[model samples]
Target: MPSLRIACFHLNQLGDLVFSLPALLALGRGFPKAQIISVARPPHRELLLLSGLVHNVVERPRGQLISKLKMVSALRSMKLDLAVLFSTSLGTAILAWMAHPREKAGFGKRGLAYRAEKIGPPSVANNLRLVEALGCRVEKRDYVGLVKLDESVRCRVRDLLMHAGIGESTPYAVISPAASGRRAIKEWTSEGFAAVAERLADDLDLVPVLVGTEADEVVAGLSEKIVDLRGKTSIIELAALLEGAHVFVGIDSGVMHLAAAVGTPVAALFGPTDPAITGPMGEGHKIVQSDVPCLACMKTSCREPLCMQRITPDAVIESVAMCVSEEKNV
Candidate 1:
């Protein structure tokens, strides 16, 4: 008999893709001999390839209709046995439908052979429901990890730190002060982050490290002690940095989830987003949010954004202290 050929239509963003890891883990467990292929966009495609979860990855087309059509032709040639859709977009649904898989699994009633309710549970647990619809036994411990990094990747990250004047034995705190899109309401004040960085240096004795894309360089020039690595590290390199951190301080964003995945204790500042729905997974996470009435409104634009403003720097400092102390105890 021919080996089973499976395809996973992956989610687009870094954190969303990380949330879907457990479901992919379920697929691997359920079909141990299957050759799994993932359809993902760049950077994430590279991240997934390094993860060792999928057998191969195909770059998802973007921008042009001609590129999408070419991808469709390529998928059609593969003659996929099963197509698992992690993205609920209409374009992804259409792509999977055009591929003509013998079995289809996805969320909602998008004409799939197996469907799971998109709502309910945290994002990670909700993703697991999709694979459970296919009779996969979801393991309790599978939801905690992100990707496996080889020794070479770690060594490269170490060299990067050495170039940045940080020694091998140095303990650092990674802080991301930016949120994606127009969600300015999700970000804490720069002054707040600066205060936290000061406390991390003076109180906790950890050097502060700023991380994000070039677009996320909002926290730069805050402190000379803070090492601004924003726009410098790739996604995998960022993971290595987070893995070595004493703790991560950030808003509700993809980097925060990445920190959690790499087993770094997260001191996450929450405002408009609900922590239960989209917060970091696993243990040793400290969530700092005000007790506002409109706490989890999910609003992208807010003139005042009282929820974020109300979160005092002292509160965040306390959380960071707790995170460090907890990690030391463990």
Candidate 2:
């Protein structure tokens, strides 16, 4: 076959982009000389830029027909050999078809009309891990890890730690107590996270770093002793920070996936969702969930979130302890 210039489309949120990194890396490895482009959103663009996997990041604009037409025109200009649509949306499939790549690939489900050399249903473990399912020859390798951080980002993180009055050498854990949507029933309460942080500090002598966006500052504010970095770090900076942490504990959010991508040990909380579908991937990660009947509802909103409420701080602390101990043994 000729050298393939591929375009991979994953126009979802941050976590989606993180999980898709391994597959993108595999593609890059398989076709080292080919130009690879990604269609992503704002923060995701920053992520892919930092990831160093794609040759180009095409910003997906927000508008109606005119904007999409412009994007299609751009795709046509690339003269791509292959287009991989990661979503099940008909619109995305249609876009791949209209782009007129020699080969279009995506899930073969729900009557999505597209000509593809490879197609399969979604995998529950990791979306990127699905590359093996595509019938492509994949080495039995540990799923490709996230891209390495540059020294500049690492130095910035060290400065951030110093500004926070945290020593660069001090081992710490990050606690993210906020979740974005109703699918985020996997999030523990602020009080619950505070309790766990307090215990971990007292017992393990590790500082607790609180992380989130500005809207999540209230959650970080609940912890008196935690080093709060909410609303401060960018997506790339957050990944660098996670790289230096000893362990990370968070709800089912983008940060948790970031920690996993950076190879940090993670204790992720799962509620009202299946860990199989969206939990943290790779080794050195543990997931804790409640046995509530209404769990895995996958609903955007819920009136009663007992599944989340029932996951006590003590339980989370225990999971963290286990991950830390395992890491030390290794």
Best by TM-score: 1
lDDT at 206, model 1:
95
Model 2 residue 25 CA deviation in Å:
3.1
Distance from true position, residue 173, model 1, in Å? 0.5
Worst 10 residues of 2 by lDDT: 115-124
- Per lDDT, the best of the predicted structures is 1
Q: How accurate locally is residue 128 in candidate 1, as Cα lDDT from 0 to 100? A: 85
User: How many backbone clashes can be found in candidate 1?
Assistant: 0
Instruction: Report how far off residue 107 is in candidate 2 (Å).
Output: 2.1
Candidate 2 residues 1-330, lDDT tens each? Answer: 656788888847677677677677777777788899998776677679777878888877665788888888999988988877776667777877788887766665533334233323233234444454444444433332664688998899899999998897799998877777635555667778878888879987889998886756656667677898887787888988998998999888878878887888999888876677777778888888777898777766677788888988878888999999999999
Q: Name the lDDT of candidate 1.
A: 0.85
- Pairs that collide in candidate 1 are none
Per-residue lDDT tens digits of candidate 1, residues 154-248? 89889989988889999999999888765678988887888888889999999999887675554566676788888777888889999999999
